[model samples]
Target: MGVLFYGSAEHAIEIDDVALAHLKVVIATKLRRNESFTLSWMHDSGQPLGRSTIWLHPSIELRFAFEEPTPPPLDPAKIQAYANSANTSGGILVPEEHILGSSRGVVLTA
Candidate 1:
């Protein structure tokens, strides 16, 4: 799992590294353009219950930490899809498979 330390207070949000990497790109792009959006993800057993959403803005500090030293290879098509979805009212939805123990590492859809 990866940790996204968000804002000045550094509230940590745990996410899958691969998924976080994809989100990093889209998030950077949006923030660069001064766009704000919410990132929603389903909670795994470790979390309390239900899903969580965070509003991202350029002014806020964000950090991504991965367990693996090296970054994962990202798919352009998938990134584009994520970016497209982010532009919508719902923003970006982190797929269940990306979360730990949600899909047993088998990707059905994102």
Candidate 2:
């Protein structure tokens, strides 16, 4: 499992390492261009039993932590799909497998 620390360490969101890897690519690409967008996901478990969305911007601190020391390989198809959603007005929705139905490890802090 990987953790995505957004804003502060206390606000860490746990996610699969592979999924986080893909998210990192998409997020990095958008922030590199100074773009801000919403990242939405459905919370099937946890305190919130519904959907959640976060505003991702260059100003906000974001970190991706993986259980493994080495980073997983990147999938171009996944990156493209994520980038496409992120570019849309609605922004990017996480649980990326839903976007590409396809299928990693590392602690990448950004």
Judging by lDDT against the true structure, name the best candidate. 1
How high is the lDDT of residue 69 in model 1? 92
- Over the stretch 1-110, how does candidate 2's per-residue lDDT look in tens digits? 77888886445666667778888889998999999999887654334345677899999999888887899888888788879989999898765234221112112221
lDDT of each: 0.76, 0.72
TM-score of each: 0.81, 0.80
TM-score of 1: 0.81
Which runs in model 1 stand beyond 4 Å of their true positions? 8-11, 102-110
Distance from true location, Cα of 45 in model 1, Å: 1.2
Clashes of each: 0, 0
Clashes of 2: 0
lDDT for 15 in candidate 2 is 69
Candidate 1 weakest lDDT stretch, 10 residues: 101-110
Which residue runs does candidate 2 get wrong by more than 4 Å? 95-110
